[model samples]
Target: MARPVTNAAFEALLHAAGYGNAHAAFARQLNHAGRNYGTWRYDAASVYWWLRGRRPAEHVQATMAETLARKLGRSVAVLELGFGAGEGTGTSIYPASAGQAIDAAERLWTTLAKHIRPPVSGTFDSGKALQAALGWRYDLPDKTVSRNGRQPVTTGDIQSLYALADHFTDLDRRHGGGSPHTRALMADFLVRQVALMLRGNYTDVVGRDLLRAAATLSGQLAFMSYDAGDHATAQHHTTVALRLAKAADDRLHGAHLLANLAAQAVHLGHARDAARLAEAAIDGAGRAPAAVLARLYTTAATAYGQSGERRACQVALAKAERALDRTGLSVGPRWVNYFGPAHLAGAALRCLGDLHLYTQALRHAPDAITLSSQNARTRALHTALIATIHARAGDTDAACDWGRKLARHAVGVHSARVEQRVRELTAMLSPQQALPQVSEVLYALSTVPAAT
Candidate 1:
C-alpha cells in the first residue's frame, strides 16, 4: 500500500498548513464537505488509505481541494494540490502565480526531504532551454505580492538571510557534500526560517530582497544535492531557484544559476543542453563582470568538448580565456567571486579530460590544482584529474602516487563528489590493482566512509 503513489504531496500540504495529523484534518474536511460516505464512518485510516492512491469518491476530491484551498488562502486546483495522477512524462512546473510557485516548491521539497524520486523533468531541445534562459530577462509579474501577513518583515530580517547564505556557502566550499545532515540543515533552515518569512508581511522592495535570499539558498541546495549524486532532487531545487531568480529580477544571479546548470548538464552527458543553457545565460546577462562572463563561456566549452565538436570547443575555450584576461580589474557579486583564471584552468582541464586528451589535461590540470587553494573540494577533483591522466598514460607508478594524494585529501573532506573522484581514480587504476602502490592507495580509499 505504501509502494504505489503515496499521497506525500497532499500530506505535505496538510502539514505545511498546520493541520497536525491526517486523522482529524481529513475527517473534518470530509465532514465540512458533507461527505459522510453512506455507511462509512470516515476515520484517519480511511484518510491514510485515500493518501495511498485510493481514489476518494468524486465529491470528496472536491472537498479535499476546497479544504486545502482555504488553508493555503488560494484557489487550489486538484492537480495543483498534487492530487494529480502520480507519474508520467512532461510534468510542467512553470507556475502561473506566486502562490502556485510556492506550492510547487513546497511539494518538491517535501518529496526530496522524504527521499522520494521526483518525476523526470520533461526534456527540452536546445531551443526551448535557450528560450527559457533568455526569457528570464523579460519583465514578469511580481511573485512576492503578499503585502499582508501576521508579522512585519524588515530589512534586517532579509540581511540575516544574506548572512546565512555567506555562512552556508563557505561550509559547502570547505567541507563538500559528504554529510547529508549539513545539507539537510540548510534545507531545514529554508523551510523553517525562509519559508516562514515568505509568509510574513513586507513592502515590495523588502519582498524582492527576501526572494533573492531564497533564490540563493535554493541554488545552494541544488548544488549540494547534485554533489551528493541526487540529480533528480537537484533538478527540482534548481527549477525553484530559477523561478525565484526570475521573480526577484536578479539577472546576474540568474545568469550564474543558468551557467551552473550548464556545467551540470555537461557533467550529466547532456552536451547540447549545456551549450544551449550557456548561450541562454549569456544572452540575458546584461553586461555582467568579466569573471561571470568567463564562467559562461568556460561551461560552453565543456559542453562542446563532450560532444566532440573540437573546433567549437576551442572557440569557446579561447573566448573563455580572453574573458578571464579581463577579469583582473572587475568586481562582481559574491556568487561569482570564486571565478578567475584558476577556475578557467579547471574548466579547461575538465574539457580536455572529457575529451580524453590526457597529455593536454596533465599540462594544465596541475596549474588548476595549484590555483584552487581557496576551494578544497575542487582542488581534490583537479588532483584526481592529474592522476587520471597519469593512469591513462600507463604511468601506473605516478598514477598510484597521485592517487594516494587524492585519497588523502578525500579522507579529510566532507564531499561525496570528491570521493567519487577517488572512485574514478580507482577505476582508472584497476588494471594495475596488484601493484603495491596502487593497492596501497586502494586500501587508503577503503577507509574513507562511503556516502549513502
Candidate 2:
C-alpha cells in the first residue's frame, strides 16, 4: 500500500472552514449543499478518495466547491481543485486562440442567461486579473476569424453593438444601477442579441471590433452591478469582460476594466486590492490618451487614500492632475468620455475626503456639481459627499441643505451606493434631524435598504 502523505489541501481547507475532522465534516458539507450521490457514503469512505487521487463525479465536485465557496465568501471553481472535467453547463475557459475565446464566450453567455447552478468561474483575484491585464498588453494569442458560421457578420453589425453598448452606458448614467427594468433589458440584449451576432461569421477586423464591443458591454454590466451594490455579481461579470478584452487583443479596454474593478474594490474597502488593480491598469495602458491616464491615476489615488497612505495618495492625485492638464479637455475615447477636469475634480473630492482633507474636499466639490446637473445618478453621489463635507465641518444647516437636495434627487434613483452614502450622511447628521428639511429627508431615505 502506498503510504498516505498528508492531504494538505483538503485538510487545510477543512481547517480553514473551522472543521475539526474531515470525515464527518465533509459529509455534513455535502448534505448542507444538497449533494447526495445515491447512497454513496460521504463520510470516511469518500474522505480518502480525493487524497487517493480519485476523481470525483462532476456534480459532486461542483457541490463540494460551492460548499467551500460559501464558507470562504468567494466563488470557487471545481477544476482548480484538481477535479476532472466539470459538468458545469458553461465553459470557463479563458481561451488561448481567438476562435476558442469566441466559442467560450458563447458558452458562458448562454449558461449565465439560463441561470444555471454553480458559478462557472472562481472569484476575481486582483493578482490574477493584474497578470491577465499585463499578459494582454505584452503577449496576446494570434487570432483568426472563422468564416464557418451559418450567418455572416458585417461592420454594420459591429457598429450596432457599439451603439447598443453606448445606449446601456447612457441608461446606467441616467438611471443608476437600480433600474431593474432597464438592466434586465440590457442583460437580455447582451445574451440574446449580442451573443448571437458574436457567434456569426465575420472577417478578422470585424470580429475584433465585435469582441471589443462585447467587452465594453460586459464592463458596463459590471459597473451597473457595482452601482446596485452587488459586488460578487459585479466581479463575476468583470472577469468575463477582461477575458473578452484579452480575446480581442484590446489592451486599453482591459486597462479600463482594471480601473473600474479597482474603483469597485475601493468602495468595498479592499484598499490594497484596489491599489494593485489600478497599478495594473496604468501599466497596461501603453500610452493611452490623457483622459484615460488621468482616470487611472485618480483611481489609484482613491485606493491609496483609503489605505491611509497620504503621501502615496497625493502623488497619484498629482499624476492624475498632470495627465488631465496635458490633455486639457481634448476629447478622449468614447468609453472614457467623462474623464475631464470636472470628473477628475470629482475624483479628487473623493480622494481628499477619504484623507480627511475636508477643506480640500469642499474646494473640489463644486467642480463636480456641474456633472451632477448633467447626471442625476452622479448628483446623488455628489449631494451625499457635499452633505458629508459640510457635516464634518460643523455646518449643520449647510449639510441639511445638501441633504434636502439629495433627497429630492434621489426620489426616482435606485442606486444602492448613492443611497448608502446618503444613509451614512444621515447617521452623521442624526442629531440635527429635528430640522424640518432634515426630518423630511431622513424619512425619505428610510426606505433604502442596507442591502443592495
Candidate 3:
C-alpha cells in the first residue's frame, strides 16, 4: 500500500504559526488548551503523526485551531489548519464580536434549515460546552442590540413570537421531539419567520426583547434535538441561543442554557463536564427566581451523582428542595415553570439511582410518576427508571411489572432519551428472559419502534 499523503497545508500553518520545527512546544500548547475537554498528554511524537497526515479527532482539531488563534492573535478557522470544513469548528463558541456572533447564528440557522445532517461521530465536546458557559458568565453583554433592517420589528411581533414559542414548547413536552414532522415544523418556523424577524429593524429595548424571545425558541429547539438524539444539532442550536441570551443581557436565560448543556453532558456520559457546566450555571445565576435556582441545583445534583460524588449530589438535591419550597407563591419565567415538584422528585430519583441507592430512589418514584401525570414523556422515563431500579435489585417480577408499565406509558411518546432507557431496561431483563414475565416484557419492547 502507498504511504499516507502528508498534510502539507497543516504543516504550512504550523510553520506560519511559529511552530516550524518545534513540534514539542506545539504539542504542549495543544495539551494545555485541551484541559477543558480532558487530560491530554500529547508530546512531540503525537504531533509528528499529524505532520505525517494523521488527522486528529474533531475536538482536538478545534483545540489546535484555537491554540493557533491565541498565538497568532487572530481568528483561525479549523479548515485553515487542513481539517475538513463543516465539522463545527468554523464558528467559535464565543465569537469576538457581536457581528461575528450574528454571522455564526445565521450560518447555523441556515444550515439547519437545509436539514443538513452532520456525520454521526458520537462525540460530545465538553470543552466547547464548558467554554460557552464560562464566556456567558464573564463576557460583557452587548452595549446595544438596536438594528436597522428592511422591515420594522414591533412589540406585537415579539409577543407573537413568544406565543409561538409557547405553542412549540407545549408540543415538544406532550408529543416529544422525536417526531420528524414536529422537528420539520420547528425548523421551518425558525427559518421562515424567526430568521426574518431577527433581521428586521428594532430599537434597543425592542431588540433585547426580540433576542430573548428568539433565545427561548432556540433553546426549545435545542432540547428537542437532544430528545431526538441529534446531539450535534442540539449543540449548534444551543450555541446560537447562548449568543442571543448574551446579546439580550438575559443572565438568567443564559444560566438556563448552561443547565441544559449540563443535562446533555450528563446524558452523553461526560459526568465531570456536566458537573462543571452545572456549577457554572449555578454560580452565574445571580438573583434568579426560585424556580430557576431549583432547576439549576437539580441539574448539579444529577451531574454530581453521575460523577459518584454522593455528598455533593445530596447537597445539591437539598438546595434544590429548599429552592422549590421558597417558590411557594411566586411565578417564575414560563420556561422554568416545568421545574416544579414533579421534576425535582424525578431528578432526585435519577441522582440517587445513579449512586446505586435503589431504596432511596424508589422513595421518590411515586411522586415522580403521580406528579408528572400530564407529562407523558417524563412519566415514561420515570417508569423506565423504576424498572431499571428493580432490575438492578434483582427483583425480576417487580422489574417486569414496571417494564410493562413503561411499555404502556411509552406508547405515544416519541423521545429518543426515553427509548434509550427502554432499551437499557430490556437489556437488563434479557438475562432473565427464561422467566415468562421477563420474556413477555422483552417481546413488548421489541414492538416499540425506534424514536425518529
Candidate 4:
C-alpha cells in the first residue's frame, strides 16, 4: 500500500527536490503576491494537507491551481473551481481527464526543476535541474507513487543525454571547464536522439515535444563550451539548439539561443556579428515570454556596448526595461524567473558601466543591490560591480566598503571570473592610492582567499 502523505512528508519531498526554501518563498508570495508577483496567494500548510488526499479548506481549493500555475508559468483562476482559497472540504477542481492531468504534472515538474538548484554535493549535484527536467518528461514520480505502476519512455538516447549533462556540469565545476570532446559528445547525442525521435514511433506531439527538450539540452551543452572559450564547439551546439527550437516550433527558445550565439561572437571579438545576431534575437523575441524578451534585449545592449554604439546600447537598455515592465503584470516562465527586475537592472547597469557610462550605470546600482538574491557568488559579483562604480565616481570609502564585502563573500567559491574582476578593480585603484580607502582596498585584495 502507498504510504499516507503527511505535511512533513510533503515538505521533505520538496526538500529532496531542492525546494528547501520554497515554503519561505511561498509565504513571502502569499504575504505580498499582489505587490510583488502580481497575483493571489495561498496558505502553505493547508495546501500541503490538500495534496495529502484530504480535502482542502473551502476557501483554499484554488490553492492547488495558484501553486501549480506559478509552477507552470501562467496566471490561473483556480478559486473558481467550486471553492475559495481555503475550502478543504470539497471535491477536486483538478481536471478529471488523465491527459489533462499528465500535462499539468509535466508542467509542474518542469517549472519546479527550473527553479530548484541542481544538487551539487556528494558524487554530483543532487536534484540537478537537467536531471529533474529529464525526469519530468521520462520519469513519473507521482504516477509511480499514486498508481503503483512504472512507465519509461522509449528514447534511451535522450535519457543518456540528461545523464551526460549532469556529469558534464560536475566536471565543469571541478575542472573549471568542460573538454571540447565532452561537449561535442553531448551535442551529437542530443542531435542524433532528436533526429531518431522525430522519425520513430512517436507522433508529432511526442516527437516535437522531445525535440524541444533535446534542443534545450544541446544549447546548454554548447554554451558550456562557449564559456570554456571553445567558440567553434559552441557554434556547433548553438546550431543544434536553433534547429531543435524550430522543430519544436518554439520561437522564444530560438531567439534566446541566438542571443547566446551573439554573446559568443562578442567574446570572440566579432563585434559586428555579435550586434547583428543580438538585433535579430530581439526582433524575433516578440513571441517569447517576457523574461526572455528582457534577456534578449539585455544581450543586444551588451553587443551594442562591445561595438561602441552608445546610442544603440541606450536604446537596447530602454527596450530591456520595457520588457521587464511587461513582466510586472504577468508571471514569467520557470526557466526565466531568475531573470527578474533586479537581474534586468544589474545586467543593463553592468553593460553600461563596461561602456564607461558611469553616471547612467549608477542610477541602476541600488536596484541591483536590492533586487539580487542572497547567493554568495551573485552577491560578490553585484557588490564588486557596485564598488567599481563607486571607485570610478571618486567615492573611495564607499568603494572600499563594498569591495571588501565582495572579497569576503567571494571567499571559498570556485569562480575565477569573480576573482579576475576583483583584480581588475584593484588595478583601477592605482590612481587613487593616496586615499586611505584605496589602501584599505589594497589590503583587502591581499587577503582575498584563493578559490577552493
At residue 251, candidate 1 shows an lDDT of 83
Q: TM-scores across all candidates?
A: 0.77, 0.75, 0.79, 0.55
Q: Candidate 1, TM-score vs. the true structure?
A: 0.77
List model 3 lDDT by residue over 1-452, tens digit each: 54453878888888888998899999999998866443579998887788777777654666687889898889776667774554344333666555555555655554455454333344457888888887888988789989887678999999998899889888887778898678767776776677677777899999999999988988888899899998877887787788889888888898999999999999989999999999988898888889999999999999999999999999999999999999975678888887778788889888899999989988997888875445888888888998898899788899999999888888878999998999899889998899888899999987775788
Candidate 3 runs further than 4 Å off: 1-92, 118-122, 372-374
lDDT of 3 at 241: 89
The all-Cα superposition gives candidate 1 an RMSD in Å to the true structure of 8.6
The digit string of per-residue lDDT tens for model 1 on 176-276 reads: 76667877777756755676677678887887778788889888888887777766566656766777777777888888888877877776788988888
Better of 1 and 4 by TM-score: 1
Task: Count clashing residue pairs per candidate.
Answer: 1, 0, 0, 19
The stretch of ten residues in a row with the least summed lDDT in candidate 4 is: 117-126
User: Which clashing pairs does model 1 show?
Assistant: 178-414
Question: Candidate 3 or 4, higher TM-score?
Answer: 3
Which stretches of candidate 2 lie above 4 Å from their native place?
A: 1-104, 111-131, 134-139, 145-147, 328-331, 372-374, 434-437, 447-452
How do the candidates rank by lDDT, highest first? 3, 2, 1, 4
